[model samples]
Target: MPLAVWFVAVVAVSFALAYLNSSGWFWIGAGAVVLLAGLGSGAFPMDLFLVLSAIFALCSVVLGVSPLRRLLVSRSLLAWYRGQLPAMSQTEQEAIDAGTVWWDGDLFSGRPDWGKLLAVPRPKLTPEEQSFLDGETEQLCAMVNDWETTQVYQDLPPHAWQFIKDKGFLGMIIPKKYGGKEFSATLHSQVIQKLGTRCSAATVHVMVPNSLGPAELLLHYGTEEQKNYYLPRLAKGLEIPCFGLTNPHAGSDAAAIPDFGIVCKGMWEGREVLGMRVTWEKRYITLGPISTLLGLAFRLHDPDHLLGSREDIGITCALVRTDTPGVNIGRRHNPLNAVFQNGPNWGKDVFMPLDWIIGGPKMAGQGWRMLMECLAAGRSISLPSSGTGYAKLAARATGAYARVRSQFKTPIGKFEGIEEA
Candidate 1:
């Protein structure tokens, strides 16, 4: 039925019910009818108005409140109804467009010639970055050809890894003093998107180091020595770093205690170094099973307040080597999502000096904040880039296949469905 007919029938029945003094039951059914008609109409939020009407009817029944009286009260349902009536008001005019044939509803303007739809302008690339992107594309094409033949996708090919490293791709966002490319955030996104079109695995591996590694933390709070040491290596890909944030006890809880054991009672003599045995069960780490360097976050149990006077405080970030004593590297698990490589990374009572702290010793209890900042920037690029690139590639592949493969005595591309009409 037409929306106007339904709405008229509803209002007529509601008036009859109100005249017969059966406002209670009548309002309920009338509100429901209005809500359904409004939704089907898709002209505005009619459901909200219906809900308010129902609330007013209920208030009148329970509190002996008249509809007019309810309207006078602050935050009354009737007030809500009056406020929303403007949203439903519409002027009679034809909202026409060049390619449109008819009005379907307010949801969308129909266009018979969809090809003529205006597209947003693509971003113009900078000169140096454009040159780099062209070079990378050629390099990646070569790599993909070799990868297809070799059945060896366990790790990046040496030449591919070398190419990325030589171009300072890993250090694009890292501080320039640390031998980084120091490219803008937009450039980083573009490069990652380009890589995603070719292979997702390589893109993620490159992203993890560039975005989530110790460089982000160092740039935020690392000591001069720590920044000097790690940033240069990270840019050169000499040190592959992974974030160790999620734990078995704290899957999504940022405030959970990680349970680091205290082996010795008294504080260490003649030094600010405090010793503890950290026992943790971590999982879902990007490079946990294979990282050479780890940016680990664990809870500290400072009894005597040696490390800036706190006990059972929140988590802290540490730059620990994977090869350190008592650290356990679990076997890599097949994630079923062919791209991101992740596995269990557990540790047993790992002891380290105070210098192991990211930013030397001052960056305690600030790991979660740092992790959020880095991961936020990382996600903005990684997922979107991969999805867009894959979609574009799939579209290209489908178009080519449709052109070559034929049906109905002609190439499928020649058909109305396949061809741009």
Candidate 2:
């Protein structure tokens, strides 16, 4: 964290790299000589000096001992290190494998390759994406008023809400055949940013469905039948969807959810069927209050060993109609007076057919992995884009207020304190 410590670490790495390549002895000669001269100077602070000394000492052992150096890279050493660790939970391992490790792996390795960072491809908008941004996106922003959306109507005007659905704004990520725009994630973020500048409520409304909702999960892990039935409906806004991962007790720690389902026989449409009686209490669901379809995450248990010998099937995701028996989808959460729909929903002993599972019976217990994988786009694109939008609005508002508001017959922006700010 300290500059001096970073400096020493970089130098130590330099020395280690020198020993690894050709002209290694000359590296030992010139770099080591210069390093020793600096250490002899005693100009650094005491704490920094100690750190430098410790690093140099470490470099000595690492470069001096051939066997020690070999052991550091040996597979046996890696295995031993792994064996000493505690068993990883599904959530822990899923989180670690969520996104790509390109830059993170390089930085953590202690010998970063600069070229790899420079080689990453850039993201740009396609012509259709640009045109849509200039056209429908702009029109949508013009149609919605932030004050009216939040305060007057307590939600986006009905016309604007319909416009959002009809325009396929919520279906940006869905494929074309599924009645969605199939836009790139970059375009999705851009759309959010533009809408965010005009209306915070609209930004969230569009963001939730495009991000980690039923559509995304279905796209990644849904069975062919599920995809065929749901994707088009979602893309066409026939169904408003919300995902319930955060329960009353588990918000940020989604994997620690206490909600559960028992896999057993059940009645469905006047017939006996193998399914689950799911019980969940989820709060802070972004669109729960008005969602026609709900995406639920809960631990699945097999006490009767119906599917296999395993008792715990880990976390499973399933699709449930809000109209399903025993489902309680009502009430609302007014977050910061924002008009976007958000609320709590829970169910008690609701029976769900096995086919309702996102990927059917075969993919039960893989819900956490699907969530983590889909989380990458939300983290990188949707949330940040809204933040970017608001940031741009803040800067513009600040500048305009400074120029228009006056103090003693002069613009407030001309004042010393205001100018400094």
Candidate 3:
């Protein structure tokens, strides 16, 4: 072959080997061997081959060295491309810190631990949970269908709401000691899946409290007094809870929230106490309009360094009654024609005792981490269960329709395309 053809062949072969094996050292070695063969055959000048060999030898040395190899692999072209984007938000960073990468070893490492994956126990429902799911959940579905067709109210009717509360659907994840059903995660997902298939509105209503409510936050981080006061009310449906995390400007970037609370002395219930004056403008808060209790996230400011030496104590989570003096709620947003109560809520100079912070005063600056941990669990369980419910509904409806509707004097489902679908 001509020298130019041989050069092209060598370059192609070197690249192919490197791409296949993910090793640049292989590319250098292959290129050197091809160049040496060409020089031996007098297909290339000795001086040119000598210069090429020197360059290839240097590249091989760099690729072979541990430190240089690590630098090259870590600062990859993909990494450089991703670096142009914004940094991970506080919520994302906290999620990483919260140990979100539980099963990702299978993705990075060539060998996967099949035994560990197989060892995870499948969740089973208790007898009481099974009864509630078979009986009360089915009854609730009928009621939801009636309400949806009648269009009697935009939100769930008062009777339906009361029935859900009475059945303990809102507190599925709360402990039995706290007056809740305390269903297992698997049972909770099952209930949500059933509810989602019937009424997405009702599913959202039930999921908020079960997944990311004051009950969850309080259970994990609330003080003894806080848990005692709130958990039962939450379990019994005496109080409706809404989480206020998304701000008008912040959206998913919870760390960028501009809502703030400044530490100060305040008057509460005709007595003086140490507290924070909170001002927040939040939107897209689920159940905001009808919620009786608010789980608020804000940037805490301690100018006097009362909480710590730092001026900003990062994000903090607190509970504020919807009926609190400065709170402004009741506005609702219509999302996708769904009757779920989601909307904007704001407060001006809302003041509460320092103990109102979830997990008490000691957890004042630890809200971001708390939210991240709760969200990691919530995101994995709730949304996927709901999505599975939707897929189930679609499959059943499509299968029924395909069987009943005929084409070419035969059922459409008999066709290969429809059967595959």
Candidate 4:
């Protein structure tokens, strides 16, 4: 390029670069100029030197006797950005807050600390886990008959379901003190991966209790009284547990749930007690039809302001017995005849004690946070492991079918279309 044209282009680039607000250019330019002046001399024009110095100064402003040069973001532009964002709910906020800030910091910086990562020890399963995987896991897979589970029973066979409970499959995430295996997250994931391969129905059966049911909630947020009473029973499979979060209107958006509970006093066992009158309709709840205990999430209201001045306390989760008065259970929704105990459950004016709340009365409106923190584990482990198992099954089936499936005296595997796959 021509000298005059090149100089103008460089000047323009330097002017544009000023908005970036970096100070490194000052040190780099100064070092280069000092080194050049110290080296063997060649005739250099004063005009060129002056122009270069000007360009270097323009490269950065903060280093030029100015304490700060950070360009303040435009208020109008920021307002437009804020307007572009959708209204976030309490559940959404908790979801965002669930992951550690440092987790993203290293990743977003494009230079994750490999030394720190490597310094972290690898997770390994105990002897018990390996033994269980080799024994009960294989036994369960042997009993799985997809045709019978999906069509005839529309669920896992009675014995197979019982075997899952007997093996403590539902209690992997629970602590040892709660009569559970207290397996590490890695072991839990591996268990899901193994179970996912042979039977999706069994996988769902085991995963539901391990992932999102009352057991998990109780472990995380339940009061001491609640934990002592519920955790062991859940771990031992004495009580089948299912969480009711998806209302008909809410679907996957837990925040939009229209199901509600009103704080009031109700007659319980011949005594007037502080409690809530909850009404809810939840669909597609895994193990719902057969669950003994229901963990229900509902918007709580204090119309009488019994707890405080605020009328609307916010979303709260409460444990309700499936056999409670006005409780509706044991209904099935045939979801493509999938072999899992998935169905809808509802209740109208069902009364539960204030103590039934997951974290008791004080945790009212904190259900979303509890759910979010617990859900991160489920989302990471259960979903990915389930998908991995399904993909393996699909690939094996496709490969097997291609060998025999033929047209024009040539196997489908020989065809270009099939070959590409």
Candidate 5:
């Protein structure tokens, strides 16, 4: 990383290229002159020689940046690098053929497409970390290609869901002790990118658990005992989780409401209990209809009254069993362009022991902050993956179609007007 070492590496590469071409000898000679002059100047100066070397190195970098940016947008450049494409071995091809539809044909072929132009690279992971991504990619391909249209909503095959759980992907960012991969933010980004290319629904499903779920909240504030209890279940997929933040009537304004859910202190069945009874309607709750565990948020009531004082009526989040006494999950709703069964969850007088509150009693009145923390790292990730994948789809389909679909006695891709646009 030092300047001298960097300069040597750059000059060596340049000389190697020069040796390949007979005319490159002249440029090599010029470089040698610059090096000798720089060395001679070094003896007579304080910092002048080092400063000139730095300027030349920086100028070389700036000169390279533009060509690299253009190469990313060039179809011809990708074609030139066709030899670098990892060949689909017979076993890999058979794996695709035996898998689902998304992995078939050009879908998983890593075909060059124009959509790469729109994608902003998030970050790169180490080669070792990126090696884990192919499994995620193949699994995602099967999920996307295998969506079956049922009498009701479209269903992701059970095998696909199981594949996700088995890959150590269900809890990507959870602690290693909890059965998660515990990868860095960069690794998570790569996994998301690979999954994104195959299916948006699968990407969402994979990310929600890793991003805004109890895994993160537990990591942030749960006691060691609490983590030991829940993190493993979540990581293993024994307990499917859903967040309960947005309420139907309240929508995004739930924090401003009163008398949303009731809380009281008492003994339940001889156990000292701080319990809550929630009565609210929440909709568009991702994974809500199918989740086994629900992470609920509500405004608390006073011990003496249903609607407590503002200070006493604090906002709280709880980890509740979706199968708890008064809870009801509705049919799947399809509001988005692509849908995988999401809908409303209603709780009428649902009660749970106070320990169900995340972080126990110590985290009281911090529901909003906790929710924000849960959502912070996940906001740009999920949507960008979806958008990038869709962009790639558009680009690949469009470019290939243009090449093959002809008009006016030529391929559409060759039309001057189209190219002008």
Candidate 6:
């Protein structure tokens, strides 16, 4: 390129970098423009340009051949950009709060403790657990003959639902003492993974209750009386549970949910008691249509300071029966043709006793933290397992197809591109 063209190119790059709000890139471009201008004005020899070109080429080679590119891009450049950016969203902050930071150091210099990583316990299923998984696997495969054809209907067949309940698939995460299988996290993931390979819809049906459902919340936070009343029923599949967390206004910002409850006297079980009158509108609730019980989260308010001096007690979680008066359920949403019973549920003036709180009155105002903690574990196990199952299924089917499918009188698998895939 001519000297004038080089000068214009450098000036254009500087403006582009400034437009992108990249201060670092703008400075680099400005430095290059100054060098080019000096060379064009005959202030620097042609040999100087040759020397600079060689230096740039050597730097490029070093960056391409070593880990220096990633070190600069990810660790240095990206880290600096992140520092200048706005604070992370509440969901991201909560996830970080829920997570553990074991070691702290730079990426390149950090030494991970291999012993600690290897010592992490693996999940083992007992004889009964293994037998249950095998039986359920066979049962699911038989019921879900063709997942594509099954999607023609609105939902899973009645027999399929009955089979799931009868097999105790909904209560896998609950404790054995509570009449549940209480399978380990590893076993729970494995069961979901295996089921997902056969039918994605069936996996959701079985995975929901074992994941972020009332069974988990009640087990972790329910009072003894609450446990006695609900655990056995949940274990026996007498109750199908769904949690109400995501609302139309609050997709991921659980802390900012507008659905609320007011402290007041309310009728419960045909008697008056100091309870909450909750008003909520939630969408994207999994199993909202068929769930017999709804695990609801809402901000608790006390206009008259009924609970205490504090007017607002932050976010609270409660268990509301779907049959409760003023509660509207049964709205369905179809996402990606998955047969999961997901939809919106709303209530005008739903009333429940104060004891209906998951951990009872004492656990009020702790719902956000509780939900985050549960999510930390669920996020690590359930979805990742299902995703892995799908990947494995895709790999198997693709490999088989590549082996048999012909292209140019030869198996497609023989192609370099096909082999790379």
Residue lDDT tens for model 1, 85-106:
7553111111111123332332
Model 6 stretches with alpha carbons more than 4 Å out: 1-111, 145-149
TM-score of 3: 0.83
Clashing pairs in 1: none
Ranking by lDDT: 2, 3, 4, 6, 5, 1
Top lDDT: which candidate number? 2
Q: Which runs of model 1 end up more than 4 angstroms from their true locations?
A: 1-126, 145-150, 248-253, 256-272, 337-340, 407-421
- For residue 32, what is the lDDT in candidate 3? 76
Tens digits of lDDT, candidate 5, 27-48: 4455546655546545325376
lDDT of 6: 0.80
Candidate 5: the clashing residue pairs are none
Clash pairs, candidate 6, are none
Better of 1 and 6 by lDDT: 6
Which structure is stronger by TM-score: 3 or 4? 3
Q: After superposition, how far is residue 129 of candidate 3 from its true place, in Å?
A: 3.8
The deviation in Å at residue 214 for candidate 4 is 0.9
Worst 10 residues of 2 by lDDT: 22-31
Tens-digit per-residue lDDT, 56-116, candidate 3: 7777777778788668765695688798889876556765686456456685766677887
lDDT of 6 at 251: 88
What overall lDDT, based on C-alpha atoms, would model 3 receive against the true structure?
0.84
TM-score of every model versus the real structure: 0.64, 0.83, 0.83, 0.82, 0.65, 0.74
lDDT of 6 at 11: 78
Question: Which residue pairs collide in model 3, if any?
Answer: 221-359
Off by over 4 Å in 3: 2-7, 10-18, 21-32, 40-43, 67-95, 105-121, 126-128, 146-150, 398-421
Per-model CA lDDT versus the true structure: 0.68, 0.87, 0.84, 0.81, 0.69, 0.80
